[model samples]
Target: MVEVKLHDIGEGMTEADINCYLVKPGDFVKADDPLVEVQTDKMTAEIPAPRSGVIKELLLTPGQTVKVGTTLLIMEDSSGGSKTVELQKVAEAVNSEAPQADAAVVVLDRPAEVKVPVGVSARLGRILASPYTRKVARENAVNIMEVKGTGPAGRITEEDILAFVKLRDHGGASTSEAGSEQQVPNISKYASEQEVPNVSQRASESKAPNVSEVGSEVKTAAGHETVGKSQDILPFRGRRKQIAKKMVQSIYTIPHCTHFEEIDVSELIALREEIKASGNSISATAFFIKALSIGLKEFPVFNAKLDEENESIQLLREHHIGIAVDTPEGLIVPVIRNVEQKNLKQIHDEMKRLTKLALDDKLTVQDISGGTFTISNVGPLGGSIGATPIIQHPQTALVSFHKTKKRPVATDQDEIVIRSIMNLSMAFDHRVADGATAVAFTNRFAQLIENPKLMLLELM
Candidate 1:
């Protein structure tokens, strides 16, 4: 039997949540067949089977986070009839600690199952609470099974526990003394007998509602009576949760600095129009990507990631640029590999194809991996002239492009003319690049865009 471990899916991914399992035990699968789907911070991807085999066992579950090198599934090679012989080979390959050790003697065992003990009342359908709530209930020595559920589907949520606590406190009864009410002795006679005021009575009288009674409605100044909506209480799950974690990590770990520049792109616009008039359609983003790739070649420092663990910076030779495509579901970056090697027409065609694939939800893991830099264009929607964009992690910089507008600029010593002007904003990791370097890089980029001939030469 061969065990399939989680392989590196790129973008510095160390772990992934198992979104779904496509196959079950005893099912035959072919080589390259999708075995499972995994969701990372960027995208959801299908993990394909390595070889034709019958699934022996599934080791992971949906919504469970798994790390790299963690075994996901066990498979029996159909071509190899002897399971023992195949497993021995797998053991030899996986266990590289002792090369001279005997592989046949080593045994691989399945992991043990963990059993969560349920209370007697809970098992009798008297309780409906989440695992976390049940743990809290056990810690407080409170029987959740006796507490009525106030959440959807008769599930006991955290709010229900708080409400229960309030009720217990106001009711003035211990769990042991629940069914009994103490007789009120004559206070005046008791005071006379003790010759002092009862301090316990004063303390009991001071207990009141902390805020308001449970199930009370809140009203706004607009006279709208608002009720607490359960829909607003959403679980942090899936892509949205993944994005939040990554954003926090990026902001806290990476030191970022932004540089902005405005450039006249009249020549580039003319070239685009000339091409389009010849029955060729291309997006402005494609033009910007082609220009940015050339600029990266001139300033290699901007195309790098900070290796904090190694206490060094990595400069990459490959020019794979990620284009951020906004989809209805979320934002996805589909990388175009080796942009320096492709012609402008080829780049334009690939961008068009990838953008369509992105919008249609047809992009694959291969299309989204291995980005050295990123470009996000806000020109199509016609928004702000310039704004700093957050850099996608593992990539050192991102370029934000704004809409082109016609503005008056000096054409020569004697006259002024209308030209197409746009803003280019570059946000970089300050740990890898400085302000002067960023300015120089963006200047070269603007030069290429302003002079179409220079951009064409760079493409060559």
Candidate 2:
């Protein structure tokens, strides 16, 4: 038997929730087979098996959070070895605290299960809740099990608590003891209330929502009313949860300020057409990427990050720009590395490759790693004219490029003329640069878009 520990899967992600278990005890598996799906802070990934084996036991449940390096399960390898011999080897390996540990894996014999106290599980129905949800429930003094959980397997979630609070208070109607009357279930005296000692501290941060909840009925200030439609409760796991985690961290840590401007892209459009006419496949995003790389060189702060501990700035020399791609799975930002080294065609081809891999769910951590900056083209998706985008964390800046259209603009001679104009919505970490610096970077970027010759010159 080998111990299956939760591996450190992503870029510095220390903990994750077991989103789902693909196998159960007694199931046979092959090496590289997906044993479970895990949702980390950065992404949703499948943890594959290291060796073929029959599952011995599952130590966790869905929505149960665990830290990296925690032993999640014990699986017996199907190598036709004697059970007693394998167990002996495992015991030896565990007892061996040698200076140089062997490559062979050791699995602990399953500990004897302590019978759950009588009447506890029967009363509370196990009260399974994510750490974040449990934290919220404790803060609000709500017994999580009393609340009818709308989550998978009747699991209580953070949103359930939020909705419960809202329905009880009726939009802050009264903060008296009266508000507590119409509340959820209470914990029985027998409920365990034992905390999982090994849970990650980040789980109690209250930054990310555990699930999306909507109350079926809410009391309006005038009176009570039905919500009219059945509400859908979505599990805040997988990619959505990852996005929420990063966005929350970004908003709380970075003092972000956006600089908005417009640029005429008629010349850039004409250049794209000319290239396409020559049987090339360069994209509009490639143009923006090249322009942004040149702009970053001109204004280094836009490509830099603020190191608060060291009280200094770290300016990155390479131009690895992340393109925010909205895939069916979720919003994934795949990085285009060393944009300054690649020509327009190269950028286009790489973007297509990365986007395809992302959509196909074949993108490895390396494919999406190492972004010095980000650009999100939210315009083509067709929602609003512009956007005040949130900065991707650890990176200092992100620019939201909106749709281009034939809009009337005043020429140098003050005559109104139609031009293909687009909006550039950019946000920068204030600690890294001031508004003037951000504007300077955007201005240089805009100039390159207006005149392709300058961008081509940068390439030379």
Candidate 3:
């Protein structure tokens, strides 16, 4: 028998929660096939099979937290050898490299007898659907098992669940075919009680109907309403717990000071319009990132890390900007590396790529690390005035952009004019930078953005 243990994936993680097992007992897997999915503090990763083997037993259950080196499962080597040295060698390989991110994998809920192809015997009842697919089913209050499997090897898919929901909701024949309500998993028990207001674009664009419970009543798909429980509980261990811990650490450790400012972005908006008219498209956040890079060149103090042990603040030369993206899972900040070295188009494209990866929960470790400074653009979500933004830990500063509105403003000539005004909140570690310096940095950023032509001169 070969033992598969959880090793330190990266970032000096001591433990992780087992998200799910891709393979169950008696299933044969090849080398590099993902055996289990684990959620660390920063990312979701999968441990691959070290060699071709038949799964013998899973030592840990889903949602169980195990420390590093804990034996996760037992496997019978198909090669008929169980040398400990061979296991050690393969384990080292799995530890050295970062695990690949795959969020669409499913959980092994319960065993139900399933039919297979000719010459294949019936296996235990197993539902095969991605975490995302299951989440959708839970949101719709539909039992995933009731949906027919159209995916490979009788795996249930998101579309299958949605179709099933539609059929049942519209009073179709499938409603009767679906098992009793007792079999359906309680959506409130498994899903988060707090509605995610700022979920990423992919989740926001989901075609699933809104089945969210409202004031102890849930609106079902059948155009009827049912009374829900007065309260619901959600597990606190995954990404939400990690985020809370980091936030508490940051708030308690760092002496935070926020400075608010408003800038006229009329010219920037017109410039973007002109660019679009010329058949080129770019996001406003891209402009903000590039302009920040130039500003960082002037005020490098904000793009720095503080080391209290050494009593020194190290200013980073490269601009790896972290963009805070809100996902269904939680808040994830994926970094765009070397922003100073890339042009606007490059930065825009890379930012889009990272946002999509974060929404899909496929961001690797390198994608979220090495951020010298972070920026949160909550403007699209409609916080119009200002916010006391929190600085990412160990990093010196963070800036949050709020909604832009067309407002009347006095020009240098004392004449009133309509201008696009956007408010921003900048939070910095007081131990590293004072409020005056933070103001100076935002002023420099505003200068370049207010006059889009100024950015051209700063470009290489």
Candidate 4:
């Protein structure tokens, strides 16, 4: 028998929450087949089989947070003939009984029965769905276990949850109406580019007045809806909890100082249009990233980490810039490595690829870690004026770019002219860099952004 333990997937993660199981006891699996999915503080990773074998038993349940090195399941080697009788007896015992409410059986053509994790209060067997799917169900106040799954191995999907919502709202629609359910709600806007969502209706409107989680809705004694201890609450686990912990640690440990500045991006915007006219389209953010890399070369102090234990500050040579992406779950920062080495086109392509991966929740640990600096662009989300952005811990500085608007400004000749002005907020660890240095750093960045062609001289 081989013990399938939860090893450290990456970034020295000590614990992870069990998401779901892909297979169950008595099911035959090949070498390197994914067995279970675990959600760490940063990413969701699957643990694969060590070798071809029969799944003996699952020792852990979904939603349980466990540490590294804990045994997740037991697998029996298929080549061992000595314990064949015992394995068969165990398998028979598992198959003979009616499916327990704690386990949901996936309908399959094969003889092996796979049991998935059940909902906390589900009395009708188990629920097979990804974490994101479950989140969508919870947000919409739908009982996930009651919804019939139409995915592989009977797994529930986002579309399935939306269909269930429409069905529930209509209260048993006719056969034709149910079949013609094509007007799906737009869920993409709910997860905006910034952490703050700009939806018309909040999740609270559909949620139960005094409910916390599903199956936990409680009514008031007087039959009047009033806010209670658990009214309109969200679960503080997974990514949300991880972000809170880090924010607290960073704010408490680092002496942060913020510097605000405005840049005239009229030239940059015109430059992008010219490039687009010539069949090359580029994002304004790509220009911002490239200009920042050049600024980091001049002011390396802001592109460094403080080693308090050794009483030294280490300036990083390579620029690994982290872009903050907001997802339905929470905020995630995926890094674009070696920005100083890559050209504008390369940077633009890599940024788009990483952002897509982040939005889809497919980012790996390698894609997020090893960041020398971080940048948050709130411009798309409509923060036009400014913000006091937080610096990622250990890194010396972080810059947030706000919306650009055409405004009148005075030129060097004392003449008024209309230019595209954008505000920026730069936060830094005051322990490592003073306000003077931070201002100088932003000045250098503003110079490159104001003059779009100035970056050509520094480009490699």
What are the runs in model 3 whose C-alpha is more than 4 Å off? 79-114, 117-229
lDDT, candidate 3, 1-460, per-residue tens: 8999999887566788887666666554557867777887777777888997666788998777788999999998867654433433443343233122111111133323222221111111124455566667777867565565566544566777788887888887353354222111111211122221221222223222233423777555696777754434466777777777788989999999999999889999999999999999889999999999999999999999888899988989999999999988788899999999998899999999999988866788899988899999999998568888778887889999999998999989999999999999999999999988988999999998999888888664
Top TM-score model: 3
TM-score of each model, paired residue for residue: 0.60, 0.68, 0.72, 0.71
Q: Give the 10-residue window scoring lowest on summed lDDT in candidate 2.
A: 115-124
Those runs of model 2 whose alpha carbons end farther than 4 Å from true positions after fitting are 27-33, 41-44, 50-54, 76-81, 84-229
Question: 18-49, model 1: which lDDT tens digit per residue?
Answer: 76565555444557756776766666666788
**Which residue pairs in candidate 4 have backbone atoms (N, alpha carbon, C) closer than 3 angstroms, thus clashing?**
none
Candidate 3: worst 10 consecutive residues by lDDT? 98-107
Candidate number that wins on lDDT, 2 or 4: 4
Q: What's each prediction's clash count?
A: 0, 1, 2, 0
Q: lDDT of all predictions, in order shown?
A: 0.66, 0.68, 0.72, 0.72
TM-score pick, better of 2 and 4: 4
lDDT of 4 by residue, 1-460 (tens): 9999999998667788776666656555557866777877677777989986667788997667788999999998768664444443433443334332222122222343222222211111224555556657778876664555666544567898799788878797333432221111111221121132211122112211133543344567778554433445565556666677788889999998889999989999989999999999889999999999999999999889999999999999999999999876678899999999998999999999999888767788899999989999989998568887777887889999999888999989999999989999999999998999988889999999989898999753
Q: In candidate 4, how many Å is residue 293 off?
A: 0.4
